[model samples]
Target: MDRPHWSVPLALVWVSSFFLHFAWEMWQVVFYEGMATASHAAAIWICTKATFGDANIALAAYLAAALSVCSIDWVRTPTGTPLFFYLAAGLLITVLFEYLATEVLGRWEYNEQMPTLPLLGTGLLPLAQWIVVPLVSLYATRLMYFGFLPMREYAANKPA
Candidate 1:
């Protein structure tokens, strides 16, 4: 089988990740102190910047998965070890960044509404965001790459 051009999956990963993370960030803003009080434009700008960062993280995770599986096309049939790498990389990056931003750098603070882990104190929503958004992004990438049809049907009907 011909290998897909690298750009295809990368582009899909970025686009899907950006939009999904943008929505997640905007929705979870209320959990962050001062975000609810911020001007609409300011909130949007902050979320947009964060979304770009999230998208970059997603791309990095995707690349890690690809490297683990030795296939750029792994997103098409994500499972087992590659999927583990993707999730692990995203979670690790998110945990470290969240700790730094919240504790060390003072980049942001969780409001009273935010539920946090005990030791790390990372916000639950952000951790959930990293887990949920990347999986959904990968699924969306697969659907977009393989068309709207179900994967099994698409595979069976595809021409050899």
Candidate 2:
């Protein structure tokens, strides 16, 4: 059967991104006292910020995967482009963006409960989620729809 339209995948990615980031933040709240004692408004504000930020990250990941996959034929898979590409690009983008935001820009801070990683100087949970969430999103999207239907159709229609 044919897969759903491009919007289907996009919606899926967007919703998944929101939920994943919220959950990540909650994990921090529980373990790292990350706003755990904050008032209801503070918690909502924090989650809202994370959701917005992650939405952008998700969009960047999709863009990077689509652009990279278009140039490299080997990366294409039956259902879509390779999930690994998305995962790798997502991780790289998220890590760099988050590292700058937290460490360099001083936009955010991690608590003592956060697990640190060498070189990254960031929490293990955040870095790991970039890998986990993107992989899950890509895999789920592929299962639900074909890989980038518009691009696939264009390539099929282009001159041999």
Candidate 1 lDDT at 53 equals: 95
lDDT of 1 by residue, 68-119 (tens): 9898879877778999999999999999999999999999999999999999
Tens-digit lDDT string for candidate 2 (1-160): 4644546666777777777777776666644445677887988788788777876787667766766556322222523454555666767877887689778998777777778777877778877888777666655555445447745675788665
Give the runs in model 2 whose Cα sits over 4 Å from its true position.
31-34, 71-81, 143-160
Local accuracy by lDDT, each model = 0.92, 0.67
Candidate 1: residue pairs that collide: none
Give TM per candidate: 0.92, 0.72
For candidate 1, the lDDT comes to 0.92
Worst 10 residues of 1 by lDDT: 146-155
